[model samples]
Target chain A: MSCNIAIAGVTGAVGQEFLRILEERDFPFSSVKMLASARSHGKKLTFKGREYTVEEMTDKSFDGVDIALFSAGGSRSREFADAVKKAGAVMVDNSSAFRMDPDTPLVVPEVNPEAIKDHKGIIANPNCSTIIALVPIWPLHNANPVKRMVVSTYQAASGAGQAAMDELALQSKDILAGREARCEAFPYQIAFNLFCHNSDLKPNGYNEEEMKMVNETRKIFSCPDIAITCTCVRVPVMRAHSESINLEFDSPITADEVRELLSTAPGVTVLDDRENNRFPMPIDADGKDDVYVGHIRQDESIPDNRGINLWVCGDQIRKGAALNAVQIAERLV
Target chain B: MSCNIAIAGVTGAVGQEFLRILEERDFPFSSVKMLASARSHGKKLTFKGREYTVEEMTDKSFDGVDIALFSAGGSRSREFADAVKKAGAVMVDNSSAFRMDPDTPLVVPEVNPEAIKDHKGIIANPNCSTIIALVPIWPLHNANPVKRMVVSTYQAASGAGQAAMDELALQSKDILAGREARCEAFPYQIAFNLFCHNSDLKPNGYNEEEMKMVNETRKIFSCPDIAITCTCVRVPVMRAHSESINLEFDSPITADEVRELLSTAPGVTVLDDRENNRFPMPIDADGKDDVYVGHIRQDESIPDNRGINLWVCGDQIRKGAALNAVQIAERLV
Candidate 1:
């Protein structure tokens, strides 16, 4: 079950997370290669008590690699996709570059692992918010079909990359010291303030981050006709992303039934406690593998009891990106 | 039309906002009385460039006062309601003590100034989140008649009071310096993090903050049967509250039409500039009176263009509390 692995963008956030997760899971690997751009070439990174020097990625970098995990960026993924396939290495891309390509299979291990079987050398990882939401939602969807969904996301700084996370910390320090916060990572100050997702707006008035939730959910569920809308805003939190989701089902579903179903679902941890008012929070999901689900309740607005509301949080770097890509690679062996 | 005024709980966060707003707006007043709990007795406060001593409120404190403004806790508001009424003063309360009371008219000046006329010697201010949401929604509902609403709130520390705001600052400082953030004003850390609104959870699985949005909107709109649901969360922001709102109309509506209707609506400022990708942010509404509205778009989840989505932010202390109470008093003159 051992494979030769190459991690592209090894110096980035998700790339760093991939190293941690692979080591923690004791992933069977006969050999490993760390690849990055010229800027990060010769950089030193340690994994599993072994030090390695990062090398510049090229078309021939994946010659003997059995699997290549690409998180450099969309452009990098697009640039290397053909080369990885030509070298016969499976590319588990954590970017939007190949997600919509008919040849690439978009996958969330818990929700659509079967889609991995049809991948044409590249498997795409769903968006962070999309993966966090669907992990708990998929179980409910199987019990009672979801007809419509309205979601509002409280996204974290990590989704933008390592630089954005550093910017949040720096801005927080400067603002606390009464200095003006610097704004290079984001368009506005992200210290104690939040804004709508900075992704380019699509023609339909939805931001790219939001449309990904809409399109990717349909793709993952293989249910294109389901109605979906999303509002994505970046919050001040550091790593985990949280979502407030409302769902309309084809038939009546109670809150207890949802709690019961998600309680046993894989990759989900139910943190609902009404008496002490304890529920899932970003701090609870930071660096964790499980998506925390709570605030489960029947939507009172829907008269037929066909509506449900859930609050979800998951690590944007782990389950949202690196861990998901690794899990897909796990099935390959 | 100037009248004598008395401010109860004149030492808290909302109390300070009340003084600043009254002075900024050039409110008409002949004389002013500053009242607080025994803890604040003999404390000196400056109002309109004049110094006044805070007096301990008593049953006779409201004597000869024309309009009494109350921002004390709910228990204090209940304890002094009869005293203010017995002294023949009209009370404008900024607490939940009388919001649901049938005899007391819950009012948001921008949405339901008419409700003030039905007050039986007491007018109640709606919840901060409710007021911020309704100011923008009222204009839309008038044009198209809203049939349902789904709202998610990004509440600021100010909603919990001055102490909570201070805790957020102190925790941010402590955490930035590699120290554990002390949790006192809130059950969880409010530094660079968020959690579900810490208000008491109802039996129906909704917190008091969320239910206020549901119940208050119905009362203010004078439409009890309107379907409404809300999810409220507390972010690390300081003074302003932000909301993501989705509305379903009785018939089809366009985003441009909704924006056109709200452009001239009182107490609302449309800040949607899609070209710049700048929509409403909490900082934009921090010290401002108007509720800033942006991200106006059609809800793709709904059919026939019957659904519209909006992002709104407003100063919780200004429009959500003191300013709203003062506006109700303005109508009495």
Candidate 2:
């Protein structure tokens, strides 16, 4: 059942997380090919207690690789998709290149494992924020059909990459010492401050990151008519992303019903403790595999009691990106 | 016309903001009195380049004051309400104690200046988050009334007081040095983390802070039928509070139309520039009197285009509290 694995872009943030997740999950891989750009060629990376040299990925790099996990940028994924498919390797892409392609199935294992069987040599991974949200939302949607959703995200630095995380720490140190913060990875100072999500704005005024949540949720849930609007903001946290979500269902639903359903749902941990005033927070989800859901309550503004609010947090590096891709790869084996 | 002014709770964060705002605006005052609790008695505070001694507030403290600006805690404001009223001084209280009182006018001067004229000696300042939100919303609502709103807040540490701001700075230093962040002013670490607003949770599962935005917005807008829901989270920012707001109006409204109405609105600065992706950030509103409104766009989910989204930021200490109260006081003069 073991197959050869090729990890492209092994030097970037999600690329590094891919290595950690693959080893942590003990995936049955016969061999792992560490592939990167020409700049990262000959660089060394350790995987599963073994040292491997990073090789530059090219048209011929996927000769015998059975499963090529790509966390490279969108352009790299698109450039190498044909090569991987020609070599008979299944490409599980963590990029926006093929997510909306009608032929390439977008998968979140917890929510849409069945979509993997329909993949035509290349399966696309959903966006980090979309995956984090749908992991908890899918179980509830199955019970009482969500009619509309309004979401606001408190995203962390990791979603931008390792460089952004490092910039946050450096900015914190510089700001604390009364020096000006250096802004390289982000357009604005991300230390003790936040701004709207830095993504290309669409003609409709929604950013690409926000639209991914809207479009990908419909693709993954197989429900295209559900109305959704999202406002995404990048906050100062370094690892995990949190969201404040308000949902209107087809019928009346209660907070207790949501808690009861998510209590045993896969990949969800209900951390709601109303009496102690404890709920989901980024610090609680830093290195966790499960998406923490809390602050579940009936939306008081909806007089019919058909609306619900949830506070959700999950590690953007783990559950949001790398682990999700690994989970999809696990199904192939 | 010049009138005597008394600033109660002169040692608190909002109290200090009151002094700065008054001086910056050149508020006409025949006499200034600095009053606080016994703990702050004899403390020296400088206003308009003159040092004044803090006096322990008592029933007689408001004897000759024409207007008393109260930023003390709710209980202290309640304790002195009668004393200030008995001495013929109009109380512009910044606590929640009297905001919903039948005879008190909860005012955001920019939104509801006429309400100030109806006050029975006590004109209450709305919550900081509410004041910041309504300043921009009021202009748009006047053009076409807002029927419903969904809001999520990114509040700063200054809302909790000066000690909380200091704690955020201290926590950032400790965490950067690889030490545990001290948790005294907040229930959890707030250096690079955020949590649900620390206010007591109501039976409806909304915290007091969220409900304040709901209730106070209704009172100030004088539209009890306007449905609202809010999720408030405290971030690590030092001064300003940011909000992501979605509004559904009575009929169709475009982003450009809303922006045109807000361009000349008093106490509001439109900072939206989508091409450069420069929207309002907390740092942009820090220590500023105007609430910065940006990210103005039509909510794509609503097909008929009755929905609009806004990103807003305002100094929680200035426009949210002290300056708002001072503006009300100016109206009286």
Highest lDDT model number: 1
Instruction: After the best TM-score superposition of candidate 2, give how far the Cα of residue A332 lies from its true spot, in angstroms.
Output: 0.8
Q: What C-alpha lDDT do the candidate models reach, one value each? A: 0.94, 0.94
iRMS, model 1 (angstroms) = 0.6
Candidate 2 structure quality by residue, lDDT tens digits, B125-244: 999999999999998999998988999999999999999999999999998889999999999999989999989999988899999999999989989989999999999999999999
What does the lDDT read for residue B318 in candidate 2?
A: 96
Report the CA-based lDDT of candidate 1 relative to the real structure. Answer: 0.94
TM-score versus the correct structure, for each prediction: 0.99, 0.99
Give me the candidate number with maximum DockQ.
Answer: 1
lDDT of 2 by residue, A1-333 (tens): 999999998999889999988988899999999999999999988999999999999999999999999998999999999999999999999999999999999999998899999989999999989999999999989999998899999999999999999999999999989999999999999998999999999887778898999999999999998999999999999999999999989889999999999999999999999898999899999989999999998887877889999999999989898899999999999
The window of 10 residues in a row where model 1 chain A has the poorest summed lDDT is: A98-107
Among residues 3 or more apart in sequence or in different chains, the pairs in candidate 2 whose N, CA or C atoms overlap within 3 Å are: none
List runs of model 2 lying over 4 Å from the truth: none
What are the per-residue Cα lDDT tens digits for candidate 1 across A44-106?
989999999999999999999999999999999999999999999999999999898888999
Quote the positional error of residue B281 for candidate 2 in Å.
Answer: 0.3
- The DockQ of predicted model 1 stands at 0.87
